[model samples]
Target: MLLVTGITGHSGRYFLQELIKNKYEGPIRCTVRETSNTFLLDNSGLKIEKVFGDLNDQDFIDRVMDGVEVVIHIYNIHHSPNIVQTAIEKKVKRVILVHTTGIYSQFKYASKGYKLIEERISQFKNDTKCPTSITILRPSMIYGDLCDSNMSKFIKMVDKLRIMPVISRGNSLIQPVNARDLGKAFFTVLMSPEKTVGNAYDLTGEMPIKLIDVFKLISKELNKKTFFISVPLSLGVLMARVLKILTLGKINYIEKVQRMAENRNYSHDNATYDFNYEPMSFEKGIIIEVQEYLKKKEGSKSK
Candidate 1:
């Protein structure tokens, strides 16, 4: 039996697609909040047991862990400790987690909590008392769908505004792995646990791209000539603060500006070698995402 969480989330939705694509014959179970939109899961054409409960609930976790051999947790990384503990207690054979590359961020506020969560997971893995083998896959900025607030928001902003404001002259490098690519990677790891277990893989995109180039690519896809105004990092942060104040905290992007100034490029050579993980190029992936976004926009208008 396989227990998969976050089946209704951004990456999870695509991961479910991979499972369907591969024609996985295992008994699958998923835990979701009562209000979580299960449209995709319902239409996935795969038999999945949907458990209604929070992962934070110990009783619920124990109930769902019954007869579960392997667990694929695609939910928030913050809940890893509890999940890992329960898996260990339940004597689950293997556990796969979707962590983030934010642990590598220079910003203390952003990386600190991830580091701590990872540390606890490490402790569990090192413990001789534990029987579960854990593999952690850390992915960079994930985009490719409307559920992605990062690139989807960027795409919408670029479409709505003629001039795009960038921080650090839009020179900072970012490697955004498509959600579909990430989902495929998860399936790849699931099939090849010998190569993935007890190790962590960085799942970045095909290449690192400048933020400026990203804006230009979207503009090209939209067939709109866009202009760029590079704002100093310090000034961008100040403006975000001002806007947050003016909006009565409805809009806050201070951390967003700070994060934009930092380079978020990572190597996936290990993932490629281990599980034949090949991600799509941003140029190609962004085109699909833009098309999907525009289609959805047109869809909403007709309703």
Candidate 2:
């Protein structure tokens, strides 16, 4: 038996889809809130038991952990310590935590929390007090389908603009891994826990692209003749600070402006060496995502 969480999220949905596509013949269980949309998981290969509740409830977690051998945590990284504790108490064999490489961002509280979770999970041990087998995957900025608030959101924002806003030369690099590729990697780890446990890997895209090139790709995909509107990072940050003051903190643009100047580039070669992780190029991935987004838009309009 296997238990998973965050089945509605971008990466979670892909992981589930990949598992089903590969014919995972096991009783799969997942957690979801009452308001979670399961439409993405309508087409499933395994029988899934949807456990309804929040992660903070220990009783609910204990109940969900019944007979579960493996736990794949795709949800909140903050609750990782608790989940790891519960899984340990339940005598679960292994836990695979889906974390993010955004820990590199020093200003992000969420990223700090993720780093804390990693530390806590690393300290876990069984009744024997030996180190527990845990596999943590820190994925780069994930983008795929409409649910992604990263590059997919970038595409939407770019489509809505005649001139794209950029920081400096917009040369700050980014390597965005598709949610679908993360799915395959998760499956590989689950299938070979012995080889994967007690390790952490950075899951990234196949190529590192400049932020400017990303905007170009979006323009090309959307068939828009958008041009760049360059802004110095310092000035953008200052404007954001002023906006924050004027809006009484209702708006804080400094973060977004500063983020544009960051280099999010990374390598997934370790993942490839570890699990044969192979992802399509950014061009192919972005095109596929745009096509899917358009298809969904067309479907919605037909209704």
Q: Find the candidate with the highest TM-score and give its number.
A: 1
Q: Model 1: runs farther than 4 Å from truth?
A: 43-45, 243-252, 301-303
User: Backbone clashes in each candidate structure, one number apiece?
Assistant: 0, 0
Which pairs, if any, clash in model 1?
none
Candidate 1 lDDT tens digits, 147-169: 79788888888899998888988
TM per candidate: 0.94, 0.92
Model 2, position 236: C-alpha lDDT score: 89
Q: Report every candidate's CA lDDT.
A: 0.92, 0.84
User: To one decimal, what is the Cα RMSD in angstroms of model 2 from the true structure?
Assistant: 2.2
Model 2, global lDDT: 0.84
